[model samples]
Target: MCIVKKFYVADSHFGHERIIEMCARPFSSVDEMDETLIANWNAVVGDDDIVYHLGDFAMNLADEDRVRAIFNWLRGRKFLILGNHDYKRVNQLHPTLARLEWMATPTTSLETTDGGHRVYLSHYAHRTWPGQHKGAFHFYGHSHGNCPPIGRSRDVGVDLPDVAFRPRTFDELTKGMIE
Candidate 1:
């Protein structure tokens, strides 16, 4: 039997030129940043993989077409956990919005099994989540590696050093958190 793979990523902030300076991203330009992000995403995520994107996907609300184009370039069956910046922009970008498997608000729970482990998904880190005491792993974004890990919860945002600004497999994410 084949086991499907699941991945997690967050805070890509695609098309946001100011983010390069704000986040101290290595890219010299927004175009370069966007290209690198797309390349990194495609490198780790396969076509069959399911990726949970924990918000702030893009900042360019003015150009819906460009945002849609960027989404088209990515690989995976993506589920969006809406972040602060995703509101008006993502809704306007119909092409990208239509392609998502599902979309939820910043604070939502997703109960799923990965690598024989139960996990929860959300956009913002939580002190206590559903099944926290029961050993259910929690994955979240929005803190962008600034927030400390709480209990079994981890920041799945791409801003972390371990993730290298790309989507990471479920096993990879859990392993990093465990270490």
Candidate 2:
């Protein structure tokens, strides 16, 4: 049996000082927020684990170094689902691009078996995603937890309480969504 562990997170918005004030993040400075986010992510994600970052990994398109640094600091094998803010900026640095396993479009279907469950991943939550009615669980990050839950679909954004400002395992997310 192939056993794979999957985790999900989104909208980190690293390096965006305005995000701290905008999101009411509990950090006094951008550096503090960045360190805390990196630490929190590394705490739960292991080296071999897989993480699907839904979108908005960082701000400041000009700061490619900061973006690459943040990517290197994070644990797990990373995959990205491009968000609104990620379009042009993410392509600026090809040097660190190899760190990611793959970069997907805003909406993509991920067919993987983790603990015998099928999962669908996207940047925005969908009311009716492919294979959703057939027991496929959908995970998304956009809307920042403001949107209501849709059937088996749940916002896996780090901004939400269920995720606790960190990447969450598939089992952890599913349990939170069911409750």
Q: Which candidate's lDDT is highest? A: 1
Candidate 1: TM-score? 0.86
Q: Residues 1-179, candidate 1, lDDT per residue (tens digit)?
A: 54557888889999999988887888899999999989999987788778888878888756878877888899877777777777654344334544443434333346677877788887878888878887789888888789999877889887799888899888788774554
Indicate the TM-score of model 2. Answer: 0.85
Q: Which candidate comes out best when scored by TM-score?
A: 1
- Candidate 1 clashing pairs? none
- List pairs with backbone clashes in candidate 2: none
Q: Which residue window of length 10 is worst by lDDT in model 2? A: 92-101
Q: Which sections of candidate 2 miss by over 4 Å? A: 1-4, 89-109, 176-179
- lDDT, candidate 1, at 151: 76
Q: What is the Cα-based lDDT of residue 119 in candidate 1? A: 84
State the lDDT of candidate 2 residue by residue for 19-46, as single tens digits. 8888788899999999999999999888
